[model samples]
Target: MRDNEKDLSWWQTFKSVGAAFFGVQSSTNHKQDFNKGKPVQFILVGLVAVILFVMSLVLAVTFVMPA
Candidate 1:
């Protein structure tokens, strides 16, 4: 919506996405090792996803809910 760059830089967001991407990428590459930590990784990802979802939902409701 607003300018892509403001207080935060693109690199910051990109790095976060990259970190998550690598976690998934390596998980696939080393399935055996990944399995050992799969539960932890899954829980971390799920928690992050849920938090993001909840925040977005709250923002949307605030903007779109009936007065």
Candidate 2:
């Protein structure tokens, strides 16, 4: 029934809500790539990126009017 008691109750509810929004759970497993398989993934991604860059360069050069 007191004003100070109401304020303290409000603060506790706010903190509990904030904690639910931001707390980290230790039971969840994080997704990870195994190092043994990483080199192949790296090479594949690199090759695809390089191919895209080269194709873009070719298209730009082919469409530009001669100066």
Candidate 3:
């Protein structure tokens, strides 16, 4: 990271990851994340998001299907 580039905050990291999940991240933000965000943070958040998504899908199916 450059001296002028600050580290990404938790909210910024979350938004960036969320945008990436939807494939709607802007080029500017993508560059910023690449340049300033920590890989571990992004990876951790992405994993958590994926797990939540999977859990939500399971719950939805469980509710909609005749168990």
Off by over 4 Å in 1: 1-37
Compute the lDDT for candidate 2.
0.43
Q: What's the TM-score of each model vs. the native?
A: 0.42, 0.42, 0.94
| Cα lDDT computed for each candidate against the true fold | 0.52, 0.43, 0.94
Runs in model 3 deviating more than 4 A are none
Compute the lDDT of residue 54 as modeled in candidate 2: 86
* Model 1: how far residue 58 lies from native, Å: 0.3
Candidate 1 local lDDT, 12-58, one digit each (tens): 33333445645654444344333333344455555776688789999
The window of 10 residues in a row where model 3 has the poorest summed lDDT is: 1-10
TM-score attained by model 1? 0.42
Give me the displacement of residue 12 in model 3, in angstroms. 0.5
Worst 10 residues of 2 by lDDT: 28-37
Q: Relative to the unseen true structure, what is the Cα RMSD of model 1?
A: 13.3
| Candidate achieving higher TM-score, 2 or 3 | 3
Report lDDT (Cα) of residue 15, candidate 3.
95
Model 3 lDDT per residue over 1-67, tens place: 6698789998899999999999999999998998899999999999999999999999999999996
Per-residue lDDT of candidate 2, residues 5-40 (tens digit): 322233333333343335531232111122122344
